[model samples]
Target: MMNTYSFPLSTLGLPNLMIQTSDGKRPVNISEIVFLESARNYTFAYLTDGSRVITSKTIGIFESPFAKHGFIRINKSIIANLSYITESCKNEGYAIRLLNGQWHTCSRRRTSKVKKVIKQLKTL
Candidate 1:
C-alpha cells in the first residue's frame, strides 16, 4: 500500500533495516529512517513507512531544533509530525486524526497546551 525501500547493512557495517510483515515474523526491506527513543538502554532507529508510531518515551528530553519544523510535543508521552496530522479538534479536550486514519487524544493534562499550539499552527 505504501512505497518502501530497503537497504542491507552487511556491506556498510550499519545495522540492517527491515519491515515487519502482517504475520509478525517476516522482515522486509524499506527505505527511510526515523529515530525513536528506546525503552531500554539506548535510542533506536526505525523505518518511517508504517514501521512504528513515534512515542514520547523514545525521545530524549533535549529535543533537536530541526524536529520543530515538522514534529510537535503533544504531551509527556507523544510527539507527532504535523505532516501526518489529518485533522484535529479541541473543546474540553484535544483529539487528532493521524495519516493512517487513527485518532489519538491529547490527555486532559495537555489539552490546553495542545490547543494553543494548534491555534498557532493554523496561522502559519
Candidate 2:
C-alpha cells in the first residue's frame, strides 16, 4: 500500500507531488520535475537535478494534475515536461529530447497533438 500526504500546494503556491520514499512522504515541486516514467504500478519522477523519486501511484493518476504544469504524455509510459524538452527529432518519428539528454518517442496516436504542442512551445 502507499502512504498519502495531505498537503496539496507547496510554498511557492504551486502544486506539490508527494513522493514515497523509505523515510516518508516528500513533497516535490511540480516545476522541478523534468519527466515521469511508468514502471508497472509505480511511477518514477525524474527531476531537473538528476534525481529520481518513486511513487506507488499509477502514472495515469498524474496525467491531469501534471498537465497544468506543462507535462504531456509523450508516450504510453512517459510523461515529459515541456520546459525540459530541448529538441524535437522530426527525422526520428516524433521523438523528443529532454534536458537530461534522454529521448522519448511519441505514440502514433499522440503524434499530431505532440507536434502541435512542441510547435507552440517553440514559439514561446
Candidate 3:
C-alpha cells in the first residue's frame, strides 16, 4: 500500500514563478501555468487563461526548479503541470488530457516515469 498524506501544493515550497515581459515582470501561480514550451532563445509559459510569458531562461533551468511543483517534462520541448493531467488514454497511443481540455502526447522515453508519478499522486 502507498502512504497517503495531506499535503497542499504550496507546502512543497514551490515559489510563485516570475517571468519577465517587455513592460515588467509578472508573478505566476503554478496552478495557472498549463505548460511551457521552449523557444529558440527563450521559453514560453502557457497559462490556463490562454496567456503566455516569454523569458530568457532555458527549459533545463525550469526542470530542476519546478519539479516539486507538479511540473514534469513530457517531451523535450514541453513541460506540463502534472496536477492538471485529468485523464490518460493508451488505446491508440499514450497521451494525457488536461483539465483545460488539452491533450499532449507523452514522449516514449518518459511514459513510464509519467505513469509512476501519476500513481504516486493518487496516493497523496
Which residue pairs collide, candidate 3? none
Scored by lDDT, model 2 comes in at: 0.81
Question: Residue-wise lDDT of candidate 3 within 2-99, one digit each (tens)?
Answer: 12223234435456877887778889877788788898668998888987888888888889777877789988888988766777777655777765
lDDT of all predictions, in order shown?
0.47, 0.81, 0.77
All models, RMSD in angstroms: 10.4, 9.2, 4.6
Number of the predicted model whose TM-score against the real structure is largest? 2
Top lDDT model: 2
**Clashing residue pairs found in predicted model 2:** none
Error (Å) of candidate 2 at residue 84 is 0.5
Candidate 1: minimum summed lDDT over ten consecutive residues — where?
Answer: 1-10
Q: lDDT tens digits, residues 1-124, model 2?
A: 1111121223366677778886799999888898999998999999989999998889999999888777899889999988777767766577888888887889999999988877766555
Best-to-worst ranking by lDDT: 2, 3, 1
- Deviation of model 2 at 106, angstroms: 0.8
Report the Cα lDDT for residue 106, model 3: 85
Give the alpha carbon lDDT tens digit for every residue of 52-81 in model 1. 533233355424542544455565545555
